[model samples]
Each structure stands twice: as C-alpha cells, then as structure tokens.
Target chain A: MTTNSSDFGPTNPPASMNSVGPPAGVPDSAAFRSAGPPARMPDPAVVPPTGQSAGPGAESEPAVSLQGVTKRYGDKYAIRDMNLKLPRGRVVGVLGPNGSGKSTMFRMLMGLSRPDVGEVKVLGRNPGWEANGSIAYLPDRARWYADHTVMRAFTWAQSLLPGFNLDSALRLAKFMNIDLDMRASAMSRGQEARLMLILCIARSVPLFLLDEPFSGIDVMSRERIIEGLIEHMSESERTVLISTHEIQEAESLFDTVVFLQDGGVVLAGDADELRAEYGSMYATMQKLYRG
Target chain B: MTTNDWQVEPARPPGMFWALIRHDIKLRRRRGVVLPRRWRMAYAIAAFVILMVSVTLEGPKAHFYLNAVWYFTFGYPFMTLGISAGRIKREWRNGTSGWWMSLSMPRWQLVLAKAISSFIRALMIYAGTYLAVSILGAYTLVLRGTFNAQTMGQFLLQGLEWNGLLVGAAPFMIAFGVLLAILSSSSARPLAPLMWVVIGGLWWGIFPIAGASNWFAVHGSGQSAAITITPAVFPAIFGSWVLASICLFLSIYLMRRFVDISQA
Candidate 1:
C-alpha cells in the first residue's frame, strides 16, 4: 500500500498534506514542481486567513473533544467519562497524581487505546492522524534503538514522518548538548531525554502531545529542556499537550491546566485564573485531589 | 497502483495497506540494531555445535536429517520466541511499551514485524541445516556406494514432510509468544519460552499415548509422531498449516483491534 497519498489513487489528498499537514496555507508546491497532474492531488493548501481560522476573538471549535471517555481494566478504572474540549492553538496540560489517568488520556488521544465508552475526536478525525502529519506525540517512556547514533535516529524519524524537519531537529539536539555521533546506548539519561524532546518539538506539525516531558529530570536539565520546548511553542497557532506529575515545574509553562482525579476531570480552567481564585495552583490541586 | 490487473477492492485501494507494510518494514530495518559482537558470536557458536552434533550422531541416512532438521526447526523457534519476547518484556520493564504503542503505528504492524522477523530467522536455520545434511549424506554415499534415485527420493520426502510440519506450527508458536509478551510483565516474560517448551513436550507425549490405544484414533494424535513419508502425510501437514495460519492471523487481528497498549 502507498504510505504516501500519491500512490494511493486519484482521490488521495494533494501532496501538500500527503506527508505533513501544510501549516495554514502552504500550497502543493512539491507536487506542482515535480510535474504531476494538479487535479489529481487533494488540495492541501492552507485555509487562507478565512473560515474557522479567521474569526475575530470568537471561539473556534475544539480540534479534540471527549465525553465520558472511560477506560476500565477489570475493577480499576484508568479514566472515566472525561469531558474535554481542546481547540486549535492551545496547550492543554493534563495534571493528575500517579494513577489519576494522565497517561491514559494521552494514550486515548494518540489512539493507542480505545476508551471503554465515550467519544474522542482529534482534528475532526480519529486519533490516527499521524498518517496526515497533523499530530506529533512523544510518550512518557521515550526510547531509541541503542545501536543507532543520534544522527541515524533523526534520519529514521524523518523518513517515517512527513513533517519531521531534520535540520531543526539536529540544531535542537546541538542546542541541548547532545552529541550526534554518540550511540543511543551510550547516552546519559538526560541526553536521551533531550534527543527525544528535540525530535518531537522540531516537527512541523500543528498538534504536539508530550507525556511527562519534565518528569524525573535534574533541575538544570529540566530547565534547559523546558526552555527549548517554550521556544518551539513560540508560534501562536500551534497546540501542545504536556502531561506531568511535576506540576510545580510544568504549571508555569501551560496556559490551561486540566486536573484529573479518580479517572475523572475534577477541575479545568485558565492557570492564572485558577491560581488567582484559589491562592496557589499547586496547593489548590493538592487540596482538590485530597478531598 | 493501477486497477488493470490487481485492483480487487474499491475501498481506499490496496496502496494504503501496502504502504503501511512498507512503512513498517522500513522502520523495523532502521531500528534493527545488531546485537553486541560477543552475543552474536555466542549464538553462532552454539548453533554450529548443535548442528555438528546432530549430524554426526544421527548418521547420513534419512533418520539423521529428519532428527537434525526437527531439532534445527525447534531451536530457532525456541530462541526467537525467547529472545523477541524478552525484548518486549525489557521494554515493559523500562517503561517503553506505552511509548511504542502510542507511536500511531497500527498494532498489526507491530505483531507482523515480530512474526516476520522470526520467520526470517527460521529460514536461515532451515537453510543451514539443509546444507549440513546434504553434505553429510553425500559423504556417507561416497563411502558406502554411489548416489541412488530411491535413496534421494526418500531423503527429499523426509525433508519436505519436516518442512510442512514446521511451517504448519510456526504461526501458533509465534502468536503464543506475542500473547505472553502482552499478558506478562517484564519479570515474568522469560517464563513464556519455558511454557512453550513444556507445552510442546506435552503435545508430543500425547501422540505416544494415542498410539498405545485404538480408541484415541478420533483425537488424530498419531499425526504428531507419524514420520512415514506418504501422500496423505503432505496433505495433512498442509491442512494443519492452513489451520494454524488462520488462527495466528485471527489472533493478531483481535490483538490489534482490542488489546490495551497502555498497560504495562
């Protein structure tokens, strides 16, 4: 089967969206220049500053919506009926204690696991949008083949992902002090984590899902990684989801914090608003969780 | 991609699935890091010793190759199931399984790679054993007499029969290993290979028991132990292979469709 759109059929989406979703309005220049029938390509040209992207201050519909999405394993429930609405261009932090379903939410969002019940919609589609290069996900236990060097890993990722920008990834890797020639097996924990983060952040995509990026990192390494991620989010219209138990460190980076407890969303809102109303975001989350 | 000779379905075309498979293979190849040189050498030495012992002890007759090939088939499957399952467990212990499952890779691709990799290993073992047996048989013929058509025919039949048997059960064995990898935690993963070996021994034991009784004919227990080269043997072996393939495919499909990849 054709991994890309061109080989599939005439009805396939144009080459612009073939490997990666064109950010906003880049045309199918690749196909046009390659000498192909323009009519056969599904137009991946960005939706020009119009349609949903152009409303003034008006709210856009959520790219991801979940209602009562629950996952149960025999008696224990990972998540229960979690009602969540994620619009375009917003970083949603999934905050919860261990076993509170933060990871489960990420899994469901990535289509790794189906909820026992409820609905999940990502970018007006199911979770398998990686094929369209619209979503990028970095899970908690980020891993790399130990035999390959950082450069090899980067090349492999780029080959599989349409929007994976190798140059940006390499630059990010260097910025993080990761030695490109070092094999993955020999890299320190901090170095491997940095490499994985760099790869995910450098991808030219709209949705970036990061699970526990700051968890289990030394303060110095943690700050560097967080700062690098912040740079990635410099664009105004990209969405990021970071799940973490290190609330104190991650709280400052997120615009919205979603508090989950007992597999259900206990509270969710603007971080500043919640902190202002409840004193400290961390304390408020603890109190809410304890109760 | 054209519809002229290959288009059998109207839905999305076959390109999507082929792309999926190719994508999986490429990723797998890239990620297939060679083991440390020491590990590779150790395995190679072990395989050579086993082949040598089996050939030398069994002689150059049909009996020798049959036993040698059987052991060879069993060895590769056992090692592959053990090693692959162990790797999966290691990922679980290191907390990487969740990350891998979340990679947007279809679950079937994961299982497919595991099975296909094992199949490739099996072919290697098969080829090595075949070459060793052929050489030994040739040596024996030169010492005793000249090559005979009847003797060669018997040898071929025996080899084919063993092949059919190996192919038939290969799928279930691999599937069982994957199922264990999914169900068991890292600490418990090593037990899966042992479970398979025990089950295999029991499976063999049943044949002897069936042969000792006439009433057990309905169980079809004789096929497991019956080594005779007959027309019926090949068909029975092929039929069994077909059945195993279907079961393996279904097991893989169900796993891809429903298994909770989020679990540790």
Candidate 2:
C-alpha cells in the first residue's frame, strides 16, 4: 500500500488561518488510512448480492462506483485497482495530467471500454447495459459524422436519445456562436469542441461524463462554454464528472475534487474543505501533486 | 435533489433502430454520388447509343439476350460487393460508426443498421443498372420483331433468378465487409484493398480444398457453354443463405463484444 502522507494534513482548521495543520473530529493520518491507498485499495469484504439492498446507512448509493477495478494494456497498467465513488448532484473535477488514466476511467464509466478486473457500476446498474441511456458522455475526441450540419446532429440526437432536448441544444449552440447550418467536418477544432459541449449539456441525464471538454478551445471561449454548462446544470439533478487538466480555470465549478497522479488518486475531498485547509484549491492541488 | 428525478427514460428498441437507419441514410445522401452526375449521364447515353447501333446493324439474337443474362449473373454481385465494401470503408474513414455507437442505441442495433443500409445501397445500384440494361435489351428485341410473350417471359424469369441469387448473397458480403471495417486498425485509411485481398485469397484457397474446382470451372466458362441444372445448384443456394445468416450473426457479435468506438 502506498500512502500519500502529504494528503493527511488537515481535518478541521482554525476559524481564521488557512494552513496545512491538524484539525478536530478525525485524526490526520486516520483519514488517509481509512480511504486506503490511492491505487489497489482493498475491496469490500462483504458484497451484497445483486438486487439486494445495501447495508444500513448506505441507502443513498453513489451515482458511480468502482471497486477494485483494474485495467491493463499489454504489460502496462492504465489504471490498477482504483476504487472511486461519485455522489449525485455534484460536479466532481477529476484533475490529472496527460496519460493519467482520466480518459480510461471515463471510457469504463461509459462502457466504451471494460476493466480487466472488478466491478463498475453506474446508477446502481452495470454500464454498457440499460445504464448507458442514463449517462451522457462527451469523449476526448470528436466523434460526430463529418458531413452532418449542427442542426442535423441535433435532429439525430433527438431521434436516438430520449433525454435529449432539441430546444436546449439549439439554445446552447446559439450561445456558443455555433452556426446550425455549418457542416461538422468544416468546423475548426474550437467549433467542434463547442458543438460536442452543446450535445452533452442539452441531455437531461443523471450522469454526465465529459473527458477533456475544453482541450482545444481558447481560454475566452472555454469560459463562455463553462458558463453555458453551469446554466444548464442548475436546472437539473445531475452529477457531472469532468476529467480535465485545466485545473485553475475550472476549479470554481467543482463541488469536490480528485487529484490523480500516475493513474492513482493522490488527494480527494470536498473542494471548500481542501480550500479551507490549504488556503486555496490551487494551492492544495499543487502541494499534493508536487509532493 | 432525488436520484429518481435524474433518471432518464429508457430508449425503445424499435424507435432506436429506425433512428439509426434514418441517420445512416442521411449520411449516405450527404456524401453525395460515387460517380459524378456528368459521368453517370455520359454512361447512360453511351449505353443507349450502343443498343441503338447494335439493333440497326446486326439485329437482336438469342445470343445477345444470353450475354445480358451472363452479365447480370456475374457482374451484379461483384458490383454489389464493391459498393457494400465502399460503405464500410466510408463509415470508418469519416468516424460515423464511432458517432453511432455513442448514441443510446445498443451496439448490435448499430451493426444491424449498417448491414441493412449497405444492402439497401447495393440493391439500389444493382436495380438501376439492371433496369437500364433490360430496357435497352427489350428495345433491341422489339426492333428485331422478336418481342413475343414466350421470349419476354423467359427474360423476366431469368432476371428474377439472377436478382434472387444476388439478394441471397448480399447479406453475407455486406456483413463480411462491416466486420473487416470494425476490426481494422486505422480509422483514416481505407481497408477495402486489404479486405479484398483477404477475401480473394480465401475464395481461391477454398475452391480446390473443397474439391469444387470442377463445379466452378463449368459455371465460369461462358454463356455459350452448355449449362446443367444439377442437384448441387439447390444445395449451393441453401448454403449461400446459411452462410449469409452466419456472417450477419458473427458481425453483430463481433460488434457488440470487440469493437470499440475509441479505436475507430
């Protein structure tokens, strides 16, 4: 087990100062120990049978859960024995560098790729089954048909996905300055990014998995896109998991944050709580990553 | 907010299937013509001119009609295979298959839709060519004062037989092409050449190994050769249908189990 000692800094801090100091309620080391290692965390000894209810106090199950999940390619581990639980009605930022298994995790959640071992559940059901309908995913790469116009794509989404809202999609596209008549193949990289965002945000699904949503767009456009996303998110009981490397730009949108390093979660907790402990979210993330 | 409030309504299979079919058609239409408009017009005009010249010169004979039957028998399937293979190659090249998978529809439905769309496309092209040739052939026969009930009935029957065989063999060819596209490594590059090579090798390897080389040689000789309607013909037709069904099932299985959108 690899313990990240730097994450065991604070539980409760003083009312005035914001620093990496020990706090009340739980011990600093105890929190890290309870959560187990960043990778290969031990699986739950007692797994309830399918269709059976979880134990007492576990009535509100997570929107997305992975227990002892490991995915490998050749001899290299993309992600290994990583356990994660994302609650509903929150925007959790999965901050990681390139090749940190962020996209792999998103693929597993969407059932675009399967894990080599262990269980992956989305909305209390296995992914790639009925759960696929409930999860609206925007992958890291552009997957739209090249010949389709924006309006055509919207029409297709409306036809295929029960949760898609054409009016909202058009509204979002208008806000993004994306022309409804422009061919998808003719669009620039930034325009394609905006188009994908509109497609994902217009869906009223339970879980939204966005992998690198703002990769190619400029900072100014990304801000606008993020604003549009936030407006739509406010109208629904949705859980969003955005895997991105642009931490400073998107930090304000996160209710909770998980910092992944080398395909392992090094630090994770509530954004404000970490902010209170380390003065700022950036500061906390920088400290954890650098350590 | 409650989790129930966020739950998405399940997508109906029938609705999803139709949507996929619609999307595939729209994609094909947007890609426009395989042959340019002027070229297609030129070909049609040339075909008409050739028919007129032939009728004005040598007149229509039974051999001319037999040649038409031969062309329909051998040429149609090869054309259909080429068109179906092109459809798969285009989908992979343009990333349309990946986009389709990202939708709410099941993977099997997506594969089935592709197969159906490919068949539809191939049938359209084959039907167009057949009608053009048949109309010209009939006109020549009419000019020669040979358009009798018996002759017309024979022509129609032969046309039906050729079309039936083509239709029976279409599903297998389409499914095989789609499977190759799904299993291909590169998204930007066309897999048709490699697929053709592999398929050609298999056909060559199977005929002699199955001791069917004599059967092939007889059928492949020419329209002038004496044709025999043996018991093997029925079994061959039945085998083609079975192979088509198996290929379709295998394509769907490979799509659901192994194909990944990210790879495409």
Candidate 3:
C-alpha cells in the first residue's frame, strides 16, 4: 500500500466528457493495454440481501435518499430510475457524463423540479423542506443581481434568508479580496465562483450542495476556492456534496465517490475502500466504465 | 417503508408577514435601482403644476380636482407594478434568480408580502395626492365662499368610493405585478401590461361609440344597450382581476415546485 498513493497522480484531469487524458498509474500508451475490460461484480458485503439499509441514528440518516427517481421530457428520459442514499457529514463527490442527469438530481434535491415517480429527500426533508434554512446549494452557473454590488448581494441574502449571516459573509469577502461595493456583473468568473462559495459558506445551513464549483477558473483561484471550502468544512455538523468531473483536483477532498451513468448509480462507496478492493482507482474505474 | 417512507415534519411555522416584507425590502434595496433624489423632486414639482392646470381647466372646481386626485391614486399602484417588472426583468437578464432562490422563503409568503407592500405603497401615493387635492379644494372653497355641509359630505362620499376602489383592487394589482415579475423571463412580456391597457381602452372607447358609456349602462342598470359587455368597460375590470389571479397562482406554483437555487 506504500505505492498505493502514487497510483493516482497529480495531473488535474478535466471531468468534462472524458476530457481528462489518463492521469497516471494506467499505461500511458498502447503498450500495456488490458486484454479485456474489467467487470464490476456486486460486492456482497456492502449490499445485504435483506434490502433494508441500516436505519437512521445507528448511522446518521442519509443526507439524500431517492427511490425510482425518473426525469423525462415528453418522450425522452433525461434521468431514469435512480435509487440512492448518501450518509450525512461526509464529503461525497458526484461524477457523470454531460447528459447523465447530474444537474437534474441536484435540481430535484433543491426543489427546482419534481421527480416523475418515487420520493427524494435532503437533510431528512423533502426538497420543499429545504426552505427552512437546512440546505445551502451552489449552482453550476452562479448569477447575481446585475445592479447589485457584492455587498448588496450579501445584504439581500442576509435579509431574505434566515440562514445567512452578514458578518461571516463580510469576513469571507475580505478573505477573498472581493470589492464588496462592485456590481456583480462586472466580476470575473473566478471572482463570481469565489463569491458564490462565500455566500454559501456564510450560511449556517447544515447541508451544502456544490454543483460544478470549479469550472473555468485559473489554478490559483481554484486552489483558493478549495482552501475556503476546507475551512468551511471545519465545522463538525456540516455535510458537503460536490459534483464535478475534475476528479484529480477534487479527489483528495472527497471521502466518498459516486459515479452516475444514465441517471442510475453505477458505482458508490468509500474512496479508500474502493482503492483497496482494486489496486488502482482510476484504472479500475476507466476499465469498468469502458466495459 | 412503502406508503409512508421518510417524512420530515415542516420545521417552521408561517412566521409574521412583516418578516418577509422586511426581507423583501432589503432585497429590493440591494438589487433594485434607486430613483435619484433630484429626479424625484422634479417629478413632484411637475405633477403639482399639472394638477393645478387640470383643476383650472375642468372648472367643476371640486369635481375637477377630485378627478386629478383619482388619476394620482392610480399612479402608485401602477408604478408598483411597473417598477417590479423592471426589477424582475433585470434579475432574469443577469441570471440572478439562482441567488434569489437560495433565500428559501415559502412562495406563498413571498407573494403575500409583496401584495401587502404594494398595497401600502399605493396607499401612500393616494395619500399624497389626497392631501394635495384637499389643500387645493379647501383654498378654492375659501375663495368662493360657497363651501357648504353638502359639498363636504359629497367630498367625503367620493373619497370613500375612490379609496375603496383602489383598496379593493390593490391585491389583484399586486398579484398581477408579481406575476409579471415571474413571466418576465419570457421575451414577450414587455407587451403584456400594454396589451392589458390597450384592451381596456378599446373596451371603453367602443362603448362610448355604441352609446353604452352613459352612467346607467355602466352600473348594469340598463338592458336595452346594443353592446352590453362586448369589448368594453365591464369585462376589463373583472377580467383583469381574474387573469391576474390565475397568473399569480401559476407563479406561486412554479416558485414552489420548479424554482431551483442549485441551478444558480
């Protein structure tokens, strides 16, 4: 296991549609290609045949739960029949292809859309319950009032949302070096991302959902955003769910990784356990996906 | 586990309505455009001069001035709707609905708060015009020496009717404005209010041409009129209210079901 850490290397891979060149550990070229793709056998230990998950409090309740979640637009299925349960207080990563319903799931959880069938819950409440200051969601594309300054945006948040605290927001603004009085439309993408993070973190809400938080930012800004996220996570009751394809940059931050294909969960488990079960995480993942 | 899977009790009660209003005001101040003080002062002066001119021209003296006050009463409610449209459109164009959604106040509460605020603003505008008219009326009465108990009573009755008309319509107007805010996301929204006004005007205009514009016909006291309610005065008032209620209901439903802050 000493060399196990080196198996996943440092080149930040773009998670956008197999856009990341193979990072490391796997054969870089055609020479060491496997004869056949790897098969994913169900792990008997993880899934008890009884079909009953360990209930709440014995282990904390799943931060999210879905049974038969399906999203369809007219005749086409945007997402189909997904069942999942994510436990509370862990950093869970959601990875999927572009059309794989990642945004749909997040939107449903945030009460933006209704699932055609089954039920979904966040922080033990249906999506509508999130209105009671329990969940903080950062969207893939963050937008603010055009005429609103960073300070004004924070003030607006503080006034309308019970969870938002201006003092914490200002501290975050100062730390990020954002000019509070500048209009939001004038901000660079990196600054907007950071501001979104700042607003989300300043809230006292227990569950945080970040959808594609690190896209289109320079390396230095990304690093700073990551650091702020870590700082925000310092509280024990906080649970963070980040959806991103940039596995290499964010892999270290996640305690668990979930892979969604075609609106169904293909793989989910403790990251460490997965690495131990298979010699290489990325290599095994790629092979399994290919198959 | 089948029927009653995982149910979370609603965590908070419907709080005081004022809390939502206060929050909304903060949001407006933060995200909204503030009319410059100088422009506001200039507008006030211009309105004052216009009211004076209309009163002089009408010559019924009290009646003419009352007409001016009536027009002024409509201004506040109209401005409430118009300005809200502008604010919401700006938010949509800039893509800020995501941030707005994260606030998580129940949709109904937000709607109710907005209605109350708009109503209150309408009252203020009416009050300003009421005072100005009252002053003008009193001075004109003093100058003519014809001021009497009957005239004062008439003024009181007219005031009651006018104020009642605005107050009754305030909720519908607020609801209509908020719906406009929601629907403004569609590109075809700018014409909505204009269409409403034009339709109303056409209805009233045609009624006069058809000879149904007389007072008896308007109050529903006459049956022999040619075009009783075709495109004119009757349907415009009640129709707008009905349409506004439906649109408001739709906006509330979408805010509750389809408003996703996570997309922000």
The candidate maximizing DockQ is 2
Q: Where does model 2 exceed 4 Å of error? A: A1-59, A276-291, B1-14, B26-66, B69-92, B96-98, B138-157, B185-198, B205-232, B260-264
Highest TM-score against the true fold, candidate: 2
Q: Which DockQ values do the candidates obtain, in the order shown?
A: 0.13, 0.29, 0.23
**Between which residue pairs do clashes occur in model 2?**
none
Over the stretch A15-84, how does candidate 2's per-residue lDDT look in tens digits?
3212222332122333434433322112221111112222332335777787777887657877776667
**Number of the top-ranking candidate, with lDDT as the measure:** 2
Question: Across residues B156-205, which tens digit of lDDT does each residue of candidate 3 receive?
Answer: 44555555555555556667667666644433446468757853674467
Q: What value does the lDDT take at residue B42 in candidate 3?
A: 97
TM-score of each: 0.67, 0.76, 0.65
Model 3 regions more than 4 Å off: A1-60, A130-132, A146-156, A162-167, A180-186, A273-291, B1-17, B26-91, B121-168, B179-264
Q: What is the DockQ (computed on Cα atoms) for candidate 3? A: 0.23
Question: How well does candidate 2 match the true structure, expressed as C-alpha RMSD?
Answer: 7.5
Candidate 3: Cα lDDT at B227: 15
